[model samples]
Target: MLALVLQELQKSKEPLSVAALSKKLNIDQSALEGMLDHWVRKKRLIENNAQGEMPANCAACSGHARSCHCSAQCPFIARMPKTYSIAAGERGTDND
Candidate 1:
């Protein structure tokens, strides 16, 4: 049953609410909540704050990699380079 829940979560791109997951898994809402709480305690899943309620994603931003803007303003931005790395073997030296 736990495996089934984890599988569903893996297949979903967006974080699902407990109610939605319960309906999809055909389990009782309260039971599903208990299972989710267990997973949270195990650190397998995270609980986010959404308007004072627990959500499946973080409160600050959505989890989509392409859509997130936090990286642009991130503190570590200065540490990253603008160019992609090329293999040394793929480039010719000045001796050529």
Candidate 2:
């Protein structure tokens, strides 16, 4: 599954939303999120946080991303769901 995820990201011409990846893998969004995190830790993928792109409603975010509750209703959050891509140095490498 990790390999498949890496392959998809490698082949994508642009960043992909978590929802799209979830559908492609036919996996629950939450579960896929966990798996993506694992790949991130392994340095096989890069997670796009979309910083400084916060919505106006994120004023109450408190700057604690992991614990922030505003994400659910934040427009920017909806537009960028922790997008992933192949690591820069590993780009186009078959070893990913």
Candidate 3:
């Protein structure tokens, strides 16, 4: 199941929110969050907090990288959700 989560992130070109991912994978949101955190600790995934500038690949961004002017508090940007993406340049990870 953990591997599945990684695979989905790898497949996506854009970062995905836990809620959207859990719905796609049919897993409970809380369970999905635990899996995401595990990958983050392993450095296989990067958690995008969405509390500051948004990444270009993030679902919230309108295709603009780093130049986002989002507020520090994400709640103000209702569409911006906490998201995750594959860690850049991570290699040889045993995605068990």
All candidates: TM-score: 0.51, 0.62, 0.65
Q: Sort by lDDT, best first.
A: 3, 2, 1
Tens-digit lDDT track of model 3 for 14-73: 788999899989999988989999999999998775433555334445444455565454
lDDT per residue (tens digit) for residues 1-96 in model 1: 976676676555545677678778999978877777776666666553322221223334332432335644544323211111112232233222
Please give the CA lDDT of all the candidate structures. 0.51, 0.69, 0.74
lDDT of 2 by residue, 13-69 (tens): 766668989888788988888888898899988776544445422434523453555
Name the regions of candidate 3 deviating beyond 4 angstroms. 50-79, 91-96
TM-score of 2: 0.62
Please report how far candidate 3 places residue 43 from its true position, in Å.
Answer: 0.7
Please give the lDDT score for candidate 3. Answer: 0.74
Model 1 clashes, total count: 0
RMSD for all candidates, in order, please. 15.5, 7.3, 6.8
Ranked by TM-score, top first: 3, 2, 1
Q: Residue 94 in candidate 2 has what lDDT?
A: 46
1 versus 3: better TM-score goes to? 3
